[model samples]
Target chain A: MENDKQKFRLLDTLYILMMIVPIVFGIVLKILTTPQSEGIAISGAKIFFTINLPIQNLPITESQIHSWLVMIAITGLCLFLTHGLKEKADTKRQHIAEWIVENAQKLVIDNMGDYFSGFAPFIAAILSLSAFSSLLALFGLYAPTSDVNVTAGWAILVFFLITYYKMKCGPVVYAKSFGEPVPFLAPLNIISEFATPVSMAFRHYGNVLSGSVISVLLAVGLQGLSSMVLGKLPGFLGEFPLFQIGIPAVLSIYFDVFSGVLQAYIFAMLTMLYVAGAFPADEYFRRKAKKSTI
Target chain B: MLELAIGIILGSCALGAGVAMIAGIGPGIGEGNAVAKACEAIGRQPECKGSVTTTMLMGCAVAETTGLYALVIAILLIFVAPGRLVDILMETIK
Candidate 1:
């Protein structure tokens, strides 16, 4: 028992040392490299390609590259997880695969009702993509959701699905929905329909981008604060970024992890709700009415 | 004159951002209400906590959309519009 206690204490000390060493190194590097006067500049994604065509130059941005990386990573992980299958319930991989599939199915069925449960895979894919893309910012990658275009793309797809499902009820009914309760309200209804995609896209994009901007500002501000406090010290000690180590990590938990996960879930949930709402409610209501009359 | 125009632009941008952030009050109140109700529901029936929480979060996110729209506009006003306005002002003066 005594031996175990000593071993645990040594391990705990080693773990703390491991964490502290890198942070101290990072602080030294940051102080040595960064100029005091320059505030951190928040800018859009860097363009990697400018294909010179006769008409226009098509530029591929950092967000596009990062999204591709995220896609490849998810695909590779899925492939690795599902490489082998067996009748016997044995492997951990199989357990995880089953759990994921089961939860996805349940999420769609529960949120979208029984009729629209066919959309489970699609919803799962969007949720995974959005979550992964948003979380990528934690690793210093340009998050795809930070770019409006990426979120717009997803929103547009959801918009198309909603319209398609709505039209499936009947073209006349779909068109008449714009008028809603009164004919004069048609323009307002139409505008609200258009606003759906715009709002969805902007919400995700703004949340992720704002979180990133705040994180950057906080880091720069902390560095400035450290310099103000530490500059009184003699020589090399004055240059140390004393405040930069543990403080930003706490903020990062909220900005990167919480916001990233929440925004992704919100986007997916909104898409599911909107798409499910577009489905015809006539049959369900008619059945309920018949039951009541009986 | 240029300096005065610049000051006006900066001042208006700051005011616009503040005004835009005021939209946050609605969502704050709405989400707070939602959470309060959800908490009450959970307190009454602990078994339904998961579903209640999910529903509450969904409603809160929807409520947040209006604030987010305002935030986008505020960000544009503060960051993008001011720079362009100053450029246009300089051109006009020239």
Candidate 2:
């Protein structure tokens, strides 16, 4: 018991250090480094720093930096949640962690069946990354999801997974399946197959980006309206954006918190559905039976 | 001539954005119908409320895609088209 306690303490220390180091390092880097981007970045994520390599210059943008921070934060949360987990679940953190894991596992099993239960972690990772990345917008940071490239990367990965699973039945069979009902529809099948990733990426990226864009437009409009309404006041108080205070908070709740989390859930759910649909139940069972026979 | 050309282009851009937003009506009606059906389903089987809500949300998100695409086009027209068009026209005239 004493040895176990010592081990727990060491792990706790490590977790704390792991959480602190990246954040501190990021802050130091941000303060010390001169921003390499020149000229006004009109829209989209602004380039923060450009690293000149022998191969090509890598321009790090706001989305990349903020995503890195979100990843670090997620890692820290995981560490904190799993820190000193006991078998009997004495602590609240342990219960929370167990509950989260149990629900995620159950969701995967329910959606994709028992055969694909292994996908729970992947789906959970997607859900957390999408959710937290979009949530970053609440803190006035550039959300990585708002940049179509990030969501496109995730969608493309999902598309590849779907394609790989579909091809497991054999590439010839898969290609033939595309022309089902009519060989003339082969081109349409190909287009639809390609459309999956594009649609998923655009759906997620557009929702988050539109939310932010609308918020900015509303804020600017509100400021102008407020100045027009309150301009009669004397001194500096006249220009104060009085009307901009409470109105935006109402919109923020819908645009940021609700829409961000909902989009994340939809994206993860769609990915699970598409991937599971790629491999039919009969094929899965046949493979399982074959393995069992061996 | 340049000022008049710029004005016409900007005005058309605004008009195009407004027209693009007409796509919003489809999703609005679709989601309303979806919610109404979901309400009926829940009323019939209250215990299935959780599943019904989830399905409704997923359907609504999918339905909203067309509206979102239109919004994106409208945003591009309003914010991007005017500037680019005006700039191109100025260069051509010069």
Candidate 3:
């Protein structure tokens, strides 16, 4: 473990840059470009980039372009940085793939106590992507995690996967897993199943959007105090922070690291739980147990 | 005008960012809790380390996302402060 720690790698640097550089760039940029009058400048459509899908008037602007330039540059640089680096993406991905295939199945059997190894990657990817997106938002770019479509798409896909997993666990028993009493409640069970994806998607996106909005408000509001004191100094000197490293730093600790990961976990955990619930009981004792419980 | 206006943009960006960073609070507590729980689990069931570790890490990664978003916002605020420059421009006009 110590040897592994000692072996400094590009991904580490890449991740650090991913974490630090963007904020630095954004801070420097924001300080340089912030305007006083919000009315006129804030208006008009700002377009960043366009794809096949049309967004009537995009929210992108020249400043946003410059902002994204820094972001894209870092991401692009990461690719180059990792290229031919000791730990190549391809190698790590391949090794991960192999490891997951080899150990994941056995581990699932041992721990999860049932089958379904094929879908583990999907779970991992969605969970990680959500986490990464929230982290990316810290740099001021619109977070993919905050996008309802992105999250909803993921949730719906997960729903189908769970259904598939349920089918695979036991075809005859799959339908029986739901609406156990009588048969009229089948629609209610189906609706409840449908509710899973909606909750799954909204849970993540809402958390991110609320965090983004609230934080923006608080940080914006903090300036209100400074603004009140502006030009109030004896010689019209600017108001200096009480302590350069205290309150804001504390705030940083709270917002930048904690909420980001929690929401991601919540999103993924809910999906997994829903999936786990879909599994049929392994009834080895009775032939009648194979029949539909519904 | 442009340069001074540009400078204040960083303030708003920082504000936005500082706000963004608030989300980190949840994750910090969460990851700590997760680590503690994982340690407890390891002590309780050493044989289940692999599964426990994997699950814990995966959960931790998810918990970390909110912080990431805030970090991004904070970065954008501190580094770019796009609105800061806009303020400078307003100052010049004033």
Best by DockQ: 1
TM-score for each model: 0.85, 0.87, 0.51
**Preferred candidate (DockQ higher): 2 or 3:** 2
lDDT of 1 by residue, A1-294 (tens): 999888756765554554345334433543554447665778777675688889988787877777776776677567655645578758897899889999999999988998887898898899999998887777666788999999999999999999998887568878978877999999999899999999999989998988888888998899899999999999999989899999988888898888888989998899989998987778546756898999
Tens digit of per-residue lDDT, candidate 3, span A37-85: 6621212213445544465754544334443544464454445344444
TM-score for chain A in each prediction? 0.82, 0.86, 0.61
Q: Can you tell me the CAPRI class of model 1?
A: medium
Q: How well is each residue in B24-44 modelled by candidate 2, as lDDT tens digits?
A: 999999999999999999999
Task: Score each candidate by Cα lDDT.
Answer: 0.84, 0.87, 0.62
Instruction: Tell me the lDDT of model 2 at A227.
Output: 82
Model 2 residue A39 distance off true place after TM-score fit, in angstroms: 17
Docking class of 3: incorrect
List each candidate's DockQ score: 0.66, 0.66, 0.05
Stretches off by above 4 angstroms in model 3 are A1-111, A169-174, A234-249, A281-294, B1-94
State the TM-score of the second chain for every model.
0.94, 0.98, 0.71
